[model samples]
Every structure is written in C-alpha cells, then in structure tokens.
Target: MTQPRIVLYSALLCPFAHRARIALKASGAVYETVEIDLKNKPAWYAPNINPASKVPAISYGAPPDSDVTKPPAGTFLLPESALVVQFIASLYPQIDYKDPIIRAKASFAQLQWDNLVAGRWRKYQFEGSEQDLEPLLEGLKQFSDSVPEEILGDEYGVADIILGPFVTRLFIFANEDIGKWAPGSGPKLVSALSGPEYDKLRKLGAKLDKWPALQETIDNDILVKKFTEILKNH
Candidate 1:
C-alpha cells in the first residue's frame, strides 16, 4: 500500500487552522504542512482550494514537484476546522473512533466546543466595543461547568484537540503583552473565567502537557513570534 500523503495549508495563530494541524498529528498520519501567508493569501487558494480563502486546507497527494492531480483513493479536501478535525479522526478509526456511540459523542463534543468559542470567546477577541466582557466570561464559565469528568479522558481525543488552540489564545490575550487587545473589562473577563471550571479544563489538558508533539502545536510564545514576523512582512 502506498503511503497516504496529506498536505496541510495553515497558519500558526489561526485557531481554525490549528484544529486541522492538531487533528492530523493526533491521527498519527504522516503529512506535509504548507504554512499559508494569511495576510497575503496565495492565488491557488482563491478558486481551486477554498473559495472563502481560509487558511487551513488539507490536500492528500504529492508535492509541487509531482504530477498527481487527484488525492489518494477515498480522499477529499476537508475545509472547515470542525469538519477537518472530524475527517482526520475518522481516518484513524482505531485510535479514537472505536464505536459508533463514541464517535457520535466525540462529534457532539467538538461541535459544542466550537459553538462556545464562536458564540462567546470570539466576541472578546474581535469585537472592540464597550469592552464589557462579563457576558463572554460567563458563557465560558458555563461551558466549563457543564462538562463532566468522564469526557476528559486519559488518552487524547477530539475534546482536547478542539479546545487547545482557543484555550491558548485566551491565555495569551490575558497575558501582559497581548492584554491590551482586551482593554477595559478584559482583566475581569480573564479573572472570572479562570476559575474552578477553568482548572478542570486544564486538568483535562494535563496529559497533553508532557507530550512534546502537542506542546509543539500550542507553543503560545512561538506563535506570538511567528505572528510578529507575519505582521512585519505584511
């Protein structure tokens, strides 16, 4: 059997792209990464790869040197972050996609996390309005409180893969350098959310702490450095 080749176009800071990259890593499938310049996107992504011009697009095939057009048999471009993660998870079913029920549960968990980030957490980042982040913090608090211990498994799964990027972003935004991005009520927002529930999430992620592969992905300071370089070039 020919080794399946997976190519990922991604940016380090992008949570969406982060999902695809981490999912691919967790799947233990060999893949090549093409770090996209999100500030100035390449032309190939506009029409062929992703019409929306998103950062993360997975192509399974040879590199620029090869002639193969189509990807490996049974392979297709998975675009959206949530879908991309699910697709990679499905590829290596033996790892975590053990049974139908587990698969469904994991999918549900992924969607829930997506919703929480999109609806609540993102508002604090993108929206620079009154800067009253109490609502946002409360929403995340609810999210953490709702999760039970059973879900935070000993082995890594979609639960950690989906949340890691956003969690890291939140931590960075709360830190000294990036804290200004939050402004007026951001400190309160961070304080409120970084509670017992937040600890639970961290505890869940503890298994990831020792894993070099996972650490390499969520290295927040490294991402800050990368983003700094990107900003300069732009």
Candidate 2:
C-alpha cells in the first residue's frame, strides 16, 4: 500500500504540534516538513492552509511544492493535533492503535488527562496561586491512578504520542525548579511525580526521551528556557 503524499506544517515549540511529529516519526511515514513560525506566520498560511493559523496542520494529496501556497481543491487539509495524529495512525495502523484494546486504553488515557490533568498544568505554570502546585499535583495523581492496566506497559500508542511531550515538560520543570510558580516549586513537583506512585507516568516520559522522534523534536534545556519566557509574560 502506498502512503499518501503528506506535508506537515509544524512548530517546534508547540506541544500540540509535537504530537504530530511524534506520530509521523513513529509511523515511519515519508513526509515533507514545513516548519512554521508561530510568531511570524507565513502570509499564505491562513487562507491557503489552516484558516485558524495553527501549527500541526497537514495538507494531504497535494504536491509538496504545488503553488507553495495554493493547495488545490480536494486537498485533505487537516488541523488540530489530536485529529492529525489519529489521521496519521489511521493511515498506518501497524504503527499505532492496531489493537482494539490499545485504542481503548488510549481513549481512556486521553480523557483522564484532559479532564483531570491538562487545565491544572496550565494554571500552575502561568498563574500565581497560593495553592501553588497542589492543583497540578492532585490532578496528576488522579490521572495516573485512573489509567488502565498495561497502559504504560510494552506498547506505545496514541496516548503516548498525544500526552508524552507535555508530560516530559512537567518532568523537566519539576526537576529544574523553574517556572512562574514559586521559586522552589519545580523541585517539589518533580519529587512527588517521581515517587513510586507515579511510576507509570515516569515510564511514559522516559520512553518519550528515548524515542527516535524525540531526539530532535524535544529538547529539555530549550523547552525549559522557552517556558521561562512564556511564564514571565504572565
């Protein structure tokens, strides 16, 4: 079976876009990458590609060099990182979610992370709270506890691709004790998340670090510096 021509419009710093890159690399798909500058986007990007002007967009069934901006009608233009990653997985099932059980676990993990963990993660980092890290920590504990058995086991599926990058950042922030949170908050978060209770989550981040896609897609030191910039502005 031949893979469709794919051009990934991505940004290195965006966690959402990072999921697409991980999926692409894990699937071994041959695709051209057009790195997008989120700050200074291309003039052609919004109208020609994603009207929302977001990274991790995909233009399929279009020539990689066609018109540079005007992707012809009928090109399957896809936006949003979760959908994009699933689309790639659908195209190459062998690489991800090939088993129904794996799919179920992925869905479960996604829900738990979004409902329990995601929002608190943002709040803890970008806004000051007397609660400090408690909100984020509690959310993480529940998220970890709710995951299905073997979710962090031998298989790497959609859950890992979608959530791993952000989780990795959390680990880094906690270890370095950096961010908009209180000065010592970083080490506190890391210490708790690293305890045996969160071992599965730790394993997930470890795998992300060891993955081939992650070698270039994720840089810990760079991300720490990047988040420093973001949190300072808040």
Candidate 3:
C-alpha cells in the first residue's frame, strides 16, 4: 500500500503542534509540514481550513481511503494538535496505536497528562515564577504515587507521548534555573516518570544529543522563539 500524504499545519513554537510532529515522526508517517506564521496567519487559514485558526491542523490523504474515515480530497482539515496526533496514530496502528484497548488506555493517560500535569506545567513556564512549580511538582509526585504501574507496563504509550516534551522541558529548565531553588523537584520528576521500560523514552526526551527532527528547533529554543514573537509584538 502507498504511504499516506499528510500535510501538518504547524508552528515550531507551539508545543501542541510539536506533539503532532513527534507523533508523525515516531509513527513513521510520511508527512509534509507547513510552517504557519502564527503571528500573522495565512489567508487560507480561516473558515476554509480551520475555523479556530490554530496551528497543528492536518490534511491527510492517500492509502486508498481504507475502512477508516478519511477526509475528502483537498477538503481535508483537522484542528487540535492532540486529536491530530491521535488520529495519525489511529491510522497506523502497528506503529503507534497498537490495539483498541491499548489505544483507549493510552488515550486516557494522554488526557490525564495533558489536562492535569501539562496544564500545571504551563502555569509555571509562562508565569515567570519559580514558586508556582512547587505545587505542580507536588501534584505530580502525588499523581505518580497513585497511578498504577500497570498503566505504563512494559511499553511506550500515549502517556509518554503526551508528557515527554514538557517533562523534558521541565527537566531542562529545572536544571538550568530552578534546580537549586527546588533541588529535589527535577530529580523527583525524572525518577517518577522514568521506569525501566521508559528508559528509551528518557533518552528520547532530554538527551544531550538533540533528537534529529528537533535539531532545527535548537536546545529549548521554542521558549525563546515564542516569547520573542509573541511578547515583542505585545
């Protein structure tokens, strides 16, 4: 079967969009990336594509439109980065989604990480206050303790996918700026998430050697790039 032609509408600075890129790359999906200038969105981005005018929208084609749902030719448009990533995973189950039950469980884990942990992490990243990360880290510690190990048993799943980027960033920022402020926070975060199965995941995340796909993005440069674009104008 021919590979699917996927066009991902993305911004380098958006972590949400990065999730889509990671999913596609990790799943081995053949995709073309369209970098959107989020500061000044393109003319085609409105009602024609995504009504929400968000980055990480997607248009997928080819593979002869299997039993699965597919978008109309040139009419394909999907918004929301998380959903787009999940949809791509669903398309290539062998690479990403695996089984229906496993997929569902992974999806739930992704949702929990996104809505709970990620949301809290963002509150710290943007706020310019080290104090805020404390409560969030505590919450994470509690979460790690409570969540069953069986949830992350023996395999990488949506939990790792969803949490990897931010956790990586947290590890980075904490080491750089806040590690001394909260000495145990960074190590605790790492230990909580990095089990034996997630060993590969830990390396994939914050390795001194940059992940090939993200080399152009720099070492934690998204934060700088985004702040430069958004904050400079404002």
lDDT of 1: 0.64
Residue pair clashes in candidate 2 = 177-186
Runs of candidate 3 with Cα error greater than 4 angstroms are 62-74, 97-105, 128-131, 146-155, 178-234
Top candidate by lDDT: 2
Candidate ranking under lDDT, highest first, comes to: 2, 1, 3
lDDT of 2 by residue, 107-180 (tens): 88788899988888877766646485677777787777766666666677778888877887777877876667
Tell me the deviation in Å of residue 109 in model 2: 1.2
lDDT of 2 at 26: 82
TM value for model 2: 0.91
For residue 114, give model 3's deviation from the true position in Å. Answer: 3.1
For candidate 1, lDDT tens digit of each residue in 109-160?
5565666645666555555344436666556655565455555666666766
Off by over 4 Å in 2: none
Residue 118 CA error for candidate 2 (Å)?
0.9
Displacement of residue 116 (Cα, Å) in model 1 is 3.9
- lDDT to native, each model: 0.64, 0.80, 0.60
What is candidate 3's lDDT per residue for 103-198, written digit by digit as tens? 665566555565666767666544535677666766555444433344344455554555555655666665444333344554555565566544
Tell me which of candidates 1 and 3 scores higher on lDDT: 1
